[model samples]
Target: MKTLLSAIILLSSVSAFANCPEFKVPKKFMARESLFSSRATDMTFDAGGNRIAKIEERLLSATTTFDLYDNKRQKIATARQRMFSGGTEIEIKDCAGKIIGKIKERVFHNMFDIYSKYSILDATGKVIAESEKKEILAPSFSVTGTNGKQLMKMRLSTFSTRSLDEWVVEILNDTQADPRILLMIPAFKTSADNRETEK
Candidate 1:
């Protein structure tokens, strides 16, 4: 029974949006996830069904890192995480080894509001975007650009189950940000959410 249940969970991860006709079929994941592990690893795709990028998250000792690669499997960028008692910070560097962007969790959120906020900054220290959990019941985040407009979102697929969390990252508006930077938002949010859950 345990093996059967595991099989079911594994299979369901691929069809996280199976019941949501509005989103059509979900992007199939190429990673093998354990029953309760929260590590973020998967291949993302665009609406045209073309492979967008691949993300692999790893946690070792005090550091957690996520590597993003292009469809050709070439390293595009690396996000190295630094965890703090108050919040978390992730530094993103391109393949050329230059810092490009940063993802930082806000230390304080509104006491009355149920939101965990994060800021996305460019290398020059300009706030480029913001991310926050918008859904209370489940994991769903809204990424808004500096203009205070929604640029993208990351949410669990409609058919996602408790055993496995299948995520769907969608871009809602046009933007000039690097696709790799935008793509890592889901994994970054996952890491932050997982850390909060542990605490």
Candidate 2:
């Protein structure tokens, strides 16, 4: 009876929140950030739990993959993706809810409202690495070293917006860098709609 009661109380505390939990995600582990009000644009976690697939309003699409590492650092499973834009460019993100690192020429305009990428770190806030977006043909990248510490490199072939239908983005391996990965937290936008509410 005591254990059951304790579980009930714990669940009650978790359920008590302004917004319902999303992505079957735990409040403590899930990192939330937003570009506009009323929408949690992104979330990130260090571990994997559930398998999810969703379609958001923006042109943003996703392909999910995972890298399984054993006792020794070995590439087990690699998540690969191919994302494109809608009529106009929107946000592109990873499964963990972070933005792509390098935005292309055409989509650069839309990135103003998005966080490009971030660093995974240790307890002391030292960066483990960082992630950003890239294209395969134009420039391909990966994390090529051991765990805890890794190196990321980006190469851009050329910049052009001639056709306008072009879109390919990848998450840059960002475990070793400065200015640690900025995890976005949902906040209010300085739009005319919210200006009245602020005052």
Candidate 3:
């Protein structure tokens, strides 16, 4: 009985240590902008399907927030972005409001049209991930780890005209990635698109 109990405890500990949840990247996901209000956008697995996350933007406010939820509508993580004169900064926090990561735009790339880069930092401000967007005719973005290994790739499917558009996400190194950060990709891409339109 003692040996069996010890084995069970060991298995539990291993499971806890390997807590990265597996999320299958759908072929295409949809994001819908609010027509009546400029307050929020809903992102789902498919058109009129289960809502996986929401991005809320306040009118005349510098901060934009995103909430990610599981299939059961349980909140997983929340991210907030504050725009400054120089660049935008993002904070990614867990449900308990503990910041897990930070994303800051590379200010030097602001003047260039070829590509834009952002560094993803951990709680201790160490760069754990880096994202870059290629400004081609068909734009695409890729996220890579500190070791320069690609973690995720996202290709724009359809441009947002009036309401809905599609983006296809491919998860490469999921084990090392925070799911909340994956959720924030679409929001970042949307912001980039808006910036291009203004220019």
The candidate scoring highest on lDDT is 1
TM-score for each of the candidates: 0.69, 0.22, 0.69
State how far residue 7 of model 3 sits from its true place (Å): 38
List where candidate 1 sits over 4 angstroms from the true fold.
1-47, 107-114, 192-199
lDDT of 1 at 107: 53
Clashes of each: 0, 18, 0
lDDT for each residue of candidate 2 in 1-199, tens digit (9 for 90 to 100): 9999999998886556222223222222221122322422222223234322212112124432222222133222222223355211112333333443321212222543422333334334443444443433442323222364335433322432322111122223443322112221111111111333445
Q: In terms of TM-score, how similar is model 1 to the real structure? A: 0.69
Question: All candidates: CA RMSD in angstroms?
Answer: 13.8, 15.2, 8.0
Name the 10 consecutive residues with the lowest summed lDDT in model 2. 184-193
lDDT (tens digit, per residue) of candidate 1 on 1-199: 9999999997786465233211122233322222325544443444455655667787778788888776677677888988778888888887756787888886555655456678888888788888887655776778888888898777787756654455766667775455666666666665555666767
Candidate order by lDDT, highest to lowest?
1, 3, 2
